[model samples]
Target: MSLARTLLDSAATTALVATMALSAPSARADEKVSIMVGGYEKQIYLPAKLTEALGYFKDEGLDVELLNEPAGVDAENEMLAGAVQGVVGFYDHCIDLQAKGKFVESIVQFSQAPGEVELVSTKHPEIKSPADFKGMSLGVTGLGSSTNFLTEYLAVKNGLKLGDFTSVPVGAGTTFIAAMQQDKIQAGMTTEPTITRLLKTGEASVLIDMRTMEGTKAALGGTYPAASLYMQTDWVEAHKDIVQKLANAFVKTQKFINTHSGAEIADKMPQDYYVGDKEGYVKALDAGKAMFTPDGIMPEGGPET
Candidate 1:
């Protein structure tokens, strides 16, 4: 299949990256292929770290090194610069890049939903909907990150202009929480663990939940495919064997996620991912795990939606 079709027909995946030289494949025996993850600790991209913890990459005879980047857009820049072989992030970047004459494609879709939740500070109980976002600052992972894109879509769909609200690049995890605590952003879009943290502290409430298929359909009109393993088109074409190995490993990870309970999956991740609250993390994962696809395949019409 054409690379573009391969990307479009499948569910959406993560952000933009730098250009590559199409040099020798990094899959040679004993050589590690580095894949940048847009916030590995975030539940949306859990499969990347989970696969590593499970030794799935080794099972495929691939020496893989997973790196973490809080912002997908920054990870995208690293990929374009050939700093990493691929990225585990939101898939909307492929379409956005394709429109700009750059080519990237998702090799394995990890989730059928965006797995993001728009959270409004509890201090702003008057803000009931996107319509109330005017004059407020919203948090996104980066200025051009997937979170930013979705935030804009929500605002526009609610009849607000781009200038109506400010988008702060507060990134996910601790930084995201800090932003909320300090009043840097009135509301923002973020993934799990962090979502659970805020809600646990009674600091924020769900303004628009897009962490599941039903929530995605209700908030964005349909299943918004997200969180995938993606690579530059040329890289995928040049290293078909390596790409296949990655696909195999990631697909296995997705299956594991499907078959296991949240606590079981949590046991495989690094302890720090728990954010010092193991119980809360497990509960949050259980609530949000439905966002992951049973198989590493994009949902129908995910790209178009």
Candidate 2:
């Protein structure tokens, strides 16, 4: 779900939230926080769903509105516009913005790895390697997204320039599937459910897989810090108490995931989140469980890696 805009071979990914919602806690809450997740129902960002399902936010006296925005940029813009309290997105984004002289801070971590795989369209049988991507149309979530950065990184690793291949902006889930069916993109990188669906349909095959920690270390030379909860430093500074409470809730959630099965966790989430494929969802969820951190804290030097 995350690849930093810039390259860092040894960096690890943290959890991200880019959601917005309006809900009440069991008790009277003192404040309301809006969180936006870049993608909903994908394995990469399942921690947020799990957290909500377990009612950890309510337990901590927080009224959270969990909203889903497909584009991380849009979610970030929401934060910039002060429409949301926090964003669950690629941790690299904090670094990306800081480099531009704006400071964004990650408060809680969800995953330590990029929970996605690179895929090649079955129709493009002639393309057998990353080097063959030259002159091909690859798909990304958007122009400045993690997938986009990974595409550029892979091309450069394969002796091709960042612009060697074309990158088409393809949204996740059904839209992504449709793009492949229409031959709009020859290959792309995406998270579970979508990746699992394509493989099950015999439309695409795995290219580079960072869903595993070993693969992550091998591919980018370190953790890429995929999903994380972040906000502008000013927000974090002004709301330390609320931020602490939020962290406490999410930390409890991480522990909850550690003690439960993926099936159990998925069952708590909305039934439609699986899109009517419970078995597939569980299978995909199980495969990526190891990618998540059992605590809400970002490891020391993890972001700088």
Candidate 3:
């Protein structure tokens, strides 16, 4: 071939390569979103973990990071400080933040039923109902936690006042176990699979199944409002597409979880998350599934209640 023809062919090839590169889908830097979880290895936040493990976030072109923290006030503070783009926990905290002029919004509802929380106590077996809580020292995650709110609501519903019982802020997870064992508090509110473990070990007995209580509707309306994906209103507005994509991914993950068995869900989870005990994980998953909503939409009054 002539030198001029060779040069032209080379130029055409380069141009074609450039065009293909430009046409191909690129990684969306804006799609990277950080989410804070209530606690590590808790079944309540399983949907977020499942979404990450199942590549649902990646499927939606979002790079999601899950940050596990204590709960309520701490999570809200982190989100307000911009350490996390969103939070997966009680919606009431979001409402509280909003009331404080923080301007937060819930994108999805993870748990509609109060599947995990319970007022458990081996020390007070006679305390079968909320009325018995008077004069008792109750354990709570923190002052602004759903546990605290529920405890107060339960007390009020039982014709008692907030100060009727003393509430000690026993942090969630291992800390709660320690507090219980040390008898730091008489009764406490906690979630599974910790609750499951606690019951299995006989460390505590459920005094009140908040799940069956009528006050649950008033506290969180009819929706349990256990956990959700919340973000600052401004941040959500700035990244509307990314937010929608993330919600879509969560919805997909939730559907997948609902259709599949617990063992199947465990198989997809990391060894650390699943802990090699399929049966236990399955049971936990079953419990968790009951709380999950198939659709990602936040239930009405979830934020306000």
Each candidate structure's TM-score, on Cα atoms with residue i matched to residue i, is: 0.92, 0.89, 0.83
lDDT of 2 by residue, 43-75 (tens): 788878778888888887888998998877778
Report the C-alpha lDDT of model 1 over 1-305, residue by residue, as the tens digit: 55557555433332111011012223444557899999988999999999999987887789999998999989988998999989998889877776776778888888899989999999899899999999999999999999999999999999999999999999888899999999999999999889999999999999999887898999999888788887888887778777776777777788899999999999999999998999999998999999998777777788878
* Number of clashing pairs per prediction, in order: 12, 26, 1
Query: Candidate 3: global Cα-lDDT?
Result: 0.69
User: For this target, which candidate reaches the highest TM-score against the unseen true structure?
Assistant: 1
Give each prediction's root-mean-square deviation over alpha carbons: 5.1, 5.4, 14.1
Q: For this target, which candidate reaches the highest lDDT against the unseen true structure?
A: 1
TM-score of 2: 0.89
Give each model's whole-structure lDDT: 0.85, 0.78, 0.69
* Over 4 Å off, model 3: 1-31, 210-221, 274-278, 300-305
Residue 183, candidate 2: how far off, in angstroms?
0.7
State the RMSD for candidate 3. Answer: 14.1
State the lDDT at 44 in candidate 3: 67
Which ten contiguous residues of candidate 2 have the minimum total lDDT? 16-25
